[model samples]
Target chain A: MKTKTAPVAVDVARPRPGPLALLAGARRGRRKLGRRVVPYVFSLPFLTLFAAFFFLPFAYAISQSVFKQQRSGLGLGPPTTIFVGLDNYAKALRDPQFWDGIKRVLLFGAVQIPVMMLVALALALLMDSAVIRFRRFFRLAFFIPYAVPGVIAGIMWGFFYSPSFSPIRQLATTTGLPAPDFLGPGLVLWSIANIATWEFTGYNMVIFFSALQAIPQEIYEAGRLDGLNEVGIALRLKLPMILPALVLGLLFSLIGTLQLFNEPLILTRLSGSITSHYTPNIYAYNVAFVDTDYYYGGAIAVILGLVTFAFSFGFLRLTRRQSGV
Target chain B: MRNWRHRASLCLALFLGVASVLSACSGGGASSGGVVQLTFWSFNQQITEQADLFNKSHPNIHVTALKQPSGPNQYYPKVLTAVKAGNAPDVALIEYQYIPTMVSNAALVDVSKYGANGVKDQFVDSAWAQVTQGRAVYGYPQDTGPMGFFYNSATFKKAGITHPPATWDEFAQDAVKIHALGPNYYITAFPPQSTGWFQGLMWQAGATWFSVDTAANAWKVSVNDATSKKVASYWQALVDKGLVSTVADFSNDWNAALNKGTIASWISAVWGQGVITGSAADTKGQWTAAPIPQWTAGAKTSAMWGGSAISVIAGTKHPQEANEFAQWYLTNSGSLSIGVKEIGWFPSNKTAQQSSDVNAPQAFYGNQVVDTVFEQAEIPTTWTWPPNLTAVNQFMGDDVNAAVANKTPIVDALDKLQGQIVQDMKSNGINVAGG
Candidate 1:
């Protein structure tokens, strides 16, 4: 029961140009070639960078993870790199310190990620409201922390946490109140988390705030028509609209928390609790450089990469499934 | 589609072109007029000045010395990576504890062929022993930190201590007396981060943390053996009694404590006087030096903490010239005098140690001849620094510092570290003998 469709009138009444079809064909050929080449030229810079820095390193690390550097006798000669298959992976898995680092970072994320997201969302919502004053100033002030380098921020917080250098500690002791040791074994993790939260909360707020800004005014009108107040409109309309931003923020924070190094590294000078294996990234670093065993470090790095990929992929798929259903 | 192929080909060509241009900018040093150029990398500016002097003296061989980052945490990785990449300097200053690791990696050249053994008689036995392994000489010892005891005379006077503690028992008793002066004061600080200092203490107690078996081609680790555990327990008792503060060495708090008379004394190497002088500005004339307290009543045994040697890197084009520079840097009176003046280097060269410049009273130690204290020290020659010492130190810093912070037995930490060190060496394909 297929019906025959008529040809377009323009195709039926097409006229030949004065230059004829041969010249037109040549011109079209050049145009097609140009169209094919132009995009590649535009993308050459970024594509080169991606291939060199990111893709090449990922490939090299994976390759190195399969090999072990071995030395014989007194180890006073050149080392030989030999194939060990999955032995490196097995070794990393069996390492108690490596697992301890992962467990510690996970514990840190469980407490830090949720608290950070809520604070960001609340701040973004507060800034979005009509009653908010000094909007530009507030945004800049909040974002300034993100602009500060992580090492510098960690050092600043380290000084603040130190019993000797901190004015707050001195003041507390003078006022007859014992200043709780912020770098103590029990509180060191939370202290690091506070530094991380202070650094990234503003960045997440910007993401959520931008998403809030993107929502049309008509959505608010629709909520108003449903007899909803401003708070209800924000809760019912704006909040759900920025779910993608929230998920993105959570994903980035999780990844960052797992790779914690600079903060704990700077704080290590102040606290005895932060070990060489305080975080997985730091442990991998100590293994590679401090311990000079790049094979094991490479294996640890690959394992961490796989775990992060699994988590991120699973999260995205789960969110999509829920939204679709 | 064929045009698409052309596009990809063009893109790849462009990438290669750009990469070549970027890499070209990293061209190495080139010499002119028959001069052989050598690059020298070290953490101290004094080394560079010494190199400059060498360049002036040697007309045919030119050297460009670079001042790298300080501390083991920052400097070691840079040189190690440079060695791997074959971009390493012709010469590098390596610490005695770290040289074994470098030798294991083949980053250092064997200077034995360059007649490094001929001048062995010029160096102290302890310094000479560190740079030589089974007759293969790696480098020349620039300096050695013979351990000593430094105290605040004012603080000692206030604590009613007549003289410096001459034995471990007396040190402990004096620590108690100093702590009794006030709640704010302690005899000294047992820095949590300075595992090298602890290792130095163990060495003084006659603990051979490492011993080599050439017949079996294996390393025997005794980090937590009887001698070491004895030293650890002694320090642990002091920590438990709150007779010593556990502040990090050279930290702002430690400096403040030293300045404010809270921490009264420091048990450190000869170079520690430099650290104290650099940090504690207000306590200039109040400081004095003494020999490290003995475990047995009359033991003169001492140990090293932070000192370095000059090694010719494996990839150097001018090995002979590089070795010559290293030798001169270590043994030359001119270079040694400059080091003594500029960076407070305690010469490992026997003749240089007797030079007027070295024997001259250091104003920082209240114009006292502090070398007498350090020179009298007799460092043991049998103790070997293992190739895995760097990792061992990190483990000590972590486990030992944890124990120190948690108010637990420090000997347990040492035992844990001993196991970890052996395991680390074995995993690295080094021969570790016995469990």
Candidate 2:
């Protein structure tokens, strides 16, 4: 076997020598070069867009975070932008409202993420099962909510959550049940969470469903042969296989929770519970726009971004370690 | 292969070049007929219509009005961005409360140079006070919203109340009597987010929260002074006693309460008359206007709440034309009539207030001359807003809401707000007194 393989390897490795062979070699070299350069050429547009829209703004925000706009005595002149390195960041860190917003979102995500992901996972599993009827219709129905824009969804849910106009409240009253104040101070966060879940569960469900589809059918067959039922197969085989997708979904939810703005902003008119500083993103927006203090706003935004990145990376690392990858 | 690559790059370059040129050509479509074109940003469509009227009358100068979003939430940020970009409109409509902020930021032109001083006597003293800082006049007052009590007459009659309360003592007694009618009923809703309305109350209570001394170049921030604290404590007691509901203003809940006759009155502004008329149309002839209850009996003093002004922005090349249009839009009888009749804005010009359209009886308030009540309510002692008024108002609202919801003392909230306003002002390099 060694003698046969050695001659084959030598023949494959041998260089061509004739003029026609040299011409062919030159052609192959050109083709190889083309193959190496084509992908970068194809990606140039995307790279340009990413740099322009994402990287440039990110760099600008970083620079802006270090400077502050100061006015003269009595603030009766045009504000002068001056360099104040890390001062804005320090002030942001000291702001009670900023911390309160961060804490509120952290609490919001802690509860919202698990509930949203579980519902999405359950729906995905149901659709992936063989016993389900009208699978296509069910999938479409589950995914339809992901198509609705966030602002439109927030407005729609605002009407439903409104105590005066909510059909839910009317139904509750007619049925002799106590009416729930969904927009009250204690329940407003959960109300926001419910809207977010309704908006994004379908999106996460699609991710999970696609991941489930990519699984080899042979593993399920083996599980069936081993006397494992559907639930057992889902828990033991399918779940572990889709762990990476679950982590990806979790990371997306984590980042999204930190950037909460639109729902709370619209809901402010409906509910007194949502203040200008209800969430970190809202606080940053109020600081930058309402207060016209973009320096501190930029600092808060950068800090939030860093926190999101760190949390997601740490989570990914933790999951990889637990999986012994 | 190299030739093909070269041709592909050339094609891409050509495409980008064409696209940029197309985008560039699509902008600046203003008329260039030797007419000086001036852009004006306004929150109301009435101003745009008035500008159209101006355009028809003036052949040499053309004014284009761009309607901005109504509230400060979106409007001020857009103005700031435009000003920063140095591409702001020549003239813009700024609310009276925001005039100090705009002036302090130097976003407005000193229109006194353009005959603004000559027309000072055209506007009400309080309205003029809003636009002028010392000798520098920044804008012409467009409208004012003096505070008033919009009460439900039907509810009052049902509760056996004969007249509107003349004092806080009488008001509190009336609230108790009104609440006695039913468990679901309250005298009024104290909306936590209604900082402007609350400010009007403070104003009526003689609380000078902000006072600027231009000669000294200093600001007196007395947000939690004795008078303001008294106002806070008084409301706190009412809220604590559950005599007033904590419904947010402009909310469906508040409207539902009003429509159902659960709330007896709205302590709002002249502009609120239109809002109530529109939102609670079923309660049309049942509603009536009265002076807001005073701290002392038989007092005629009142305070201003919401209003706006028209100003030339600092960077405008056509300051003369912009000021001319502003003066015309505000002072001209034809323009004033249009604003009063078409737009719901209460005129800031004394002559405009005296116009027949304003003096005419309205069907909304049971044919009462509601404008007369507002006219008297624009008292000279109305509170002046500080340069940092927006931030101060927001902090007050947030803290007040927290106090109301958490059952904490409202005076404590005021104290916290006072500290925050001082810190915020000082951080912005404003010289703050009583810090």
DockQ of each: 0.45, 0.41
Highest TM-score among the candidates is held by which one? 1
**What TM-score, to 2 decimals, does candidate 2 have?**
0.90
Clashes per candidate (backbone, < 3 Å)? 0, 0
For model 2, the DockQ equals 0.41
Provide the lDDT at A268 for model 1.
Answer: 89
Model 1, A35-57: lDDT tens digits are: 99988878877888888777887
lDDT of 1 at A228: 96
Q: Which ten residues in a row have the lowest lDDT in candidate 2 chain B?
A: B22-31
Against the hidden true structure, what lDDT does model 1 obtain?
0.86
lDDT winner = 1
Off by over 4 Å in 2: A1-37, A321-325, B1-37, B213-216, B378-382
| lDDT of each residue in B1-435, candidate 2, tens digit only | 688899789768855865686467444424477788899898676777788889898998898888887643678777876776577888898888888888766789998998898988988887798888889888999888788898999999999998998888888999999999987699999988888889888988988888776676788878788999999998988898889888888777888889888898999888788788767888878889999899877787778787889999977777888889888999888788888887777888989887888887878789998888876663655356788766877798788888887788888988899899988888888887645
How would you encode candidate 2's per-residue C-alpha lDDT over A1-325 as one tens digit per residue? 2344343222243365677666666777788899999999877766766776688878988998999888767886678889999998888889888999999999999999999999999999988998899998988898898899888888999999887789998899889999899988889999999999999999999999999999999999999999999999999999998988998898899999989988888888777778889999999888887787878888998998888889888888888844444
